[model samples]
Target chain A: MAEAGAPIIEAIGLTKTFKVAQKPPGFAASVRHFFKRTYKEIPAVTDVSFTIRPGEMVGFLGANGAGKTTTLKMLTGLLHPTAGRCVVDGREPFARTRDFLSAITLVMGNKQQLLWDLPARDTLRLNAAIYGISDADYKSRVDELSGMLELTDKLDQPVRKLSLGERMKAELLASLLHGPKVLFLDEPTLGLDVNAQVAVRAFLRRYNERTGATILMTSHYMADITALCSRVLVIHEGKLVHDGELAALLRRFGTRRELRVELSHAVDDAKLRTLGEVLSHEGNVARLAVEPAALVAVVGRALAELPVVDLTVHDPPIEEVVGRVIGKSQRALPNVVGAEQGA
Target chain B: MNAALRKMGGLLSVYYAYMTAYRAELILWALANSLPFILMGAWYQAAAGGAFGFTPVDVTRYFLAVFVIRQLTVVWVIWEFDQDVQRGRLSQYLLQPVDPVWRYLAAHLSERVARLPFSALIIALFFLIFPPARFVPHASDVLLAITFATLAFALRFVMQYTLALFALWTERASSLESLMFILYLVLSGAIAPLEVFPPELRELVMWTPFPYFIWVPARLLIGGADVDLMRATVVCVSWIGSLLVVNRVVWRLGLKRHSSMGA
Candidate 1:
């Protein structure tokens, strides 16, 4: 249900560079550089560009320092690009006009906007005031968000006293109180348990469905991508490597399938190896990795040969797929000097 | 303008609630800043009968006023700004519709709002213990002193905040702030009154904004409110204007060059 109307966020040749102090491994070099420093241009996000239509939830996949967060910051107007143009909702983000700021929200997991010593409810009200929300609107929004997130009981306690998961929920409430049209989420579900992750993912999906606000999210967790985002953008070494449907990206890069077999009795390792590369064997269950083409053949024979009670085939995990794709991109790392870096 | 002021009022109240919740910590800080009370006693012993045209009663009034003025004007925003830039906590504010300056300024002002009453209560207890400390000014003088104290607070805050923007370049900006703090202790009438200094040195120190930050307000309240009010207000306003201009320049440059490297 994401927007197909027009692009709300766009970046054209966005670039950012930092002057990194370079020093040799000696006290002499250190002292010399301290006096007359030698520096090099470490490009954080070099000539990157993309466009996000309204109501689209897109995932950004990359390794650490691969310019994922840098690109997000540039898009959010936190950093002025060293060389290019970025406009969000038809206004330059760096200008940070009230209208532009009110239309967008950036949620960074490492930083918080909540009052640490007060209740989350207070912070939410403070945000409402800052965003110029009326009392009726503020109350309705808080009620809706807190009810959806199942955090009604937790809003009254000090933020520091809440668990990690509750605090993240409160963060989501605080960020969404303004009814922003665009959301920039960087690792919003970091350091949470599986159940909490599922809750947050569900809330995000529901929120997107309800509000139709476009969301651009960067996450290391594949579940976050697969569960919430339909489209994905994979960046490696600060260059866009792939951008398409999540399933298609997985198929293009997901080379292996897992074969899970349930045998009547514990099987020997040798027999299991005859079918495919045995990943694990414990009791009557066995998981094996097989080529995509051989997946059916392997599962068919394993059921007939062994005293198999059940068999299932599933796509390879996303971590392995991401690693493989990033590895290939690293090997093909061309002399990408600031110019050929567009999506 | 009305909407912005209303928002600021709401923010200040919210932070006031936060301060109430964290009042225990504020109490500890009140106790921590009581080192000046000891210095007050030292001054009393050194100038037993009279010294430097300051009688025993003058010394008592000066330190009490110093204690209250220091409490009203001191700010830790530099340390906070340094940490925010270094740790990238500033991104949260940058994302919002408001300027981070107003948000932090409200926070700093609200904290003083919460803690000022506690300091006043302590001053009352001091008055009970020390008879010579009872020096109440006229209503107009109190009003003027309040305005001057506010300007003084703004000056010191802007100066520290503007310099703290240096954290965009280095992590040790607070170290520089520590040196400035030492100068305030010596010259701002925190350690000793400007009345006790040599005429030449005192004249020079009084001309700078440091004395205005603490000494003028202190003098207005306790030193018989006898000093030149017009010149002091002019100097405070001029200092505020210069510091605000520097802050705007530094803030722009810092934001341009900031990488927010850590987070």
Candidate 2:
């Protein structure tokens, strides 16, 4: 008999390498490749391993080319690891047995599974049949999902007619109709507005709570991680750098918090520098990076000495903390804006 | 019984929705298939009096049967497979409990059903003008024809699906399909009746599985059945069986290679 509360997914020393053909940028090089080609081994993932207990929701984080997506693909059986092994619910994902496939689902924001020309209800019926769900079960699940996602009005409409947010909601409902035990969601909220993002987040949280399904998700959105995941695994350049509590990640890399002070009068830059490291000063607004322990003292002194009108303290946005933890240079902070933003 | 029928009925309705969505493309496909009619006219005129012991009427019946068989057995697995593998759509099917082959088969059958009404109208018009025989066969011969025709369809589908598996290793699945199409066109008696071919060529065509796909069924429908034809029916069944085994093997091996390569 299986353990009642064991980890639903386990990986050991998983690695994947791709043989990328090397070709010069020219007609001559293209012709040469046609006749005789040279190839180089590009290691996309290396020696990364982790485990997830049943019902645990884990966030996967990494910069571009950091092997986050590749790792997820391996876990989901979409790709085979070049070295090492992974087991999802005691089955090898690469085998892709029908029983194994029926138990898991992968939802990609950029890739849609819903039939383009058909309505959501058609897809739902097709999936229900494919999963061998009884009619009563299928109906009840569909009804529940429709109510939760507000898809009742949109089920009969062609999927092409739905907006991106609406379409994603339908995709989610269709994918989950099978009552999968594991879900591998890759940027499930990639292009949705803030309200849509929150709705999806709320849905995911409730689903996880109610069903006790293991979820492995990767997102560039810090809000998603902060809101849904208590634990995160950070990878960089095909290597695992950190895997533990989300708070631990913050404590290790998020050593400083920004304190924005609105002064009643324009403050001298030199005086602010004496209070804390002056990050920026423009007009009566000044920004300072204060150590966590010094935040209270610094705020008190600034309020007592300077004509402060308003003040707010916040941790550096997750993007910056992640960048710093990955050993990216401070000068590269601006580039973080483009890394997995909003998703 | 009604509930079971309802499930099956619902499947067809969903298929209908897909067809209606692509109704314009269906019309274009019907137009493209008129090439066989053009060929039939050209051949009928050439055989105005007689050619190779076949009269113009015989040519008309044979070509019309050829047209119907060709349309019924039409499949484009190579293109579908290539696109799915390249674009990662195959993963979507993998995520489901249903076998991808069944879904592909359903989609293929649904498209055929959608085109049935238009095809029936064309056949009806041809019959009204020419008035060919209704082809009432002996009970045993009818059984043989139905059995062999079904096996032929299955063989053709599986063989093409197996060939499509080459997309896992090479990028020339379309070229491969073209080569198969040329072979089928020549060997399956789609362009001309096998009876018109030289004796030696006819013998060779009989030995290959290509003839069973179109020529055998069309011959059975138009030329009537023979007791000796049961031998050919057996051959068709064996071919289907072997091809099914080969299809499973190829699918398993190709999936292994694909997973390792991470396409």
Candidate 3:
């Protein structure tokens, strides 16, 4: 049971396994599989547990197929756990009791709850009815969300006619109309442009602050996590790897820093090597990895004696930090950014 | 009671929204559901010169009543259930406060209400064109018809939904649904009267629940009010009640398996 004013979300030893059919590729093999088949039990979520207090904005981070979405589904009562138990507001999620469902909401980026051919407002009205919201509460919440999300102009338009960003804003409004106490947001900003992503992140933060709703969000955009979450839970290969403050994860796994320098005269790779590991050198521009404590001295030496034109020092990009934390090879930095963008 | 009424109202609101969302689709479905009336006209014309237990005029009344009763009692649970499972929309409903089945029922009933205006027009036109002597109303028959029709709808929805659970394991559930429909068409007297079937088949149909889906209710609506019809109404209600319990059990067991397999 949840203590009065305690965490609204709790999980213990949650696990899920899927039995997927395994078939060899080939016409003959396919024919054989029709008669005789093999199956493999793949564990999508291992024994993982976490507690989220009321009004806490927590980011869930993991690589693709790392079980973050699966965990979210379990929390929202979409999928029952294979083993162990979970409770949302002191009720078992899979039971899906009326009171329990009325108190929580799940918003998925790609999936829509809105009626596609109808105006978003229709869906909003439907949700209001489903959640049994009072007319005044519904109107006020819609007004507030409309102003913040800039959805006032688009609410009357059919969802199919709206742009992706517009549709997302409407979706957000529909989910929040019920005024759920807990929110499970799965990649809620997926496929949105940078500006749209920022807008969504800001809206979520404000909504959380204003409503005191506990929010659990999963996103590949480290920027979203960095801006919105004080704490994060990272999972890799269906197992929890790290759970702590976002800054601490950055501090522990974000070891390397990038040093980009522009030289007045093109310097040879050998000279750049003496200062630090030369990450890249082309023409007069070069990038290097410098020790965090020795960054100033290295910059000073390069500027005083070396033919330096410009220099800037910064921590390694978040994509690289996350990739390393997940045990991926760091030899390919550009691919890390690509992977994160794809996610 | 207040809570229940509030929930029902909420569900009706959602149903209205869904219908308004797909007004064009709703129009198309209403047309399709009335196709049986067209078949009735053709069949009635074929038996024009001869009396086959029903005159052409009586055929008109009987088929029109069937049309109205069918419209009221029909459910598309199998299709909706199959689509939800296939498209993964079942998750959204499962997470909601209300049982997914109740939501399905609400949506279905809402569509019925929306189409009532059009269906009432058809009923009115049929009565005006084919005024028959046997169209007299009886209080007992009216009550029995309502009771049987409600049970028939519930039984059919629950049974089909239970069958739809087979999709969790088998990929060919649609084929199974077609087979179920065929059984209903032959034994439930959706295509014709149950008594028209050979004695052996009628006996089999009587022992099964198929007649309760259509034949019993249609018979009651046609003023076949008697103690036997009352007994059949009880049997139909019992079947619906049993199926409801069975559906709950199947859902519990299926959910257990789904959780274990992580679907």
Identify the leading candidate in terms of TM-score: 1
DockQ of 3: 0.39
Report candidate 3's fraction of native contacts. 0.59
Docking class of 2: acceptable
DockQ of each: 0.56, 0.36, 0.39
- In candidate 2, list every pair of residues with a backbone clash: A220-A343, A221-A343
Across all candidates, the chain A TM-score values are 0.82, 0.81, 0.81
Off by over 4 Å in 2: A254-319, A328-343, B1-13, B128-146, B225-227
Write the residue-wise lDDT of candidate 3 on B1-263 in tens digits. 76567777877876776776666676566667675577677768765856356677656655666676778877777777777777767777676656677778888888888877777766777667766623765778778878878887888888888887766665225677788888887787667766557879776678678888777777787776432765676677788788888888888887666555554
lDDT per residue, candidate 1, B91-194, as tens digits?
A: 78878887778877888888898998788888889989987678777777677667778888999998898888888778659998889988988898888888
Better of 2 and 3 by TM-score: 2
- Regarding DockQ, does 2 or 3 come out ahead? 3
Q: Give a tens-digit lDDT track for model 3, residues A1-343.
A: 4578766888888898888889989999999999999999999988887777878899888888989989988887778888878888888888777888888888889788877877898888767766778889989999998998988989988889998888898989998887788989998999999888989999999998888888999987777888899878777777766666777677666656789998888878988898899988999999998877788888888888688778888657655665666774235433432343233
Worst 10 residues of 2 chain A by lDDT: A334-343
- Tell me the lDDT of model 3 at B181: 81
Which digits, one per residue and each the tens of the lDDT, describe model 1 over residues A289-310? 8987887787778878999998
Q: How do the candidates rank by lDDT, highest first?
A: 1, 2, 3
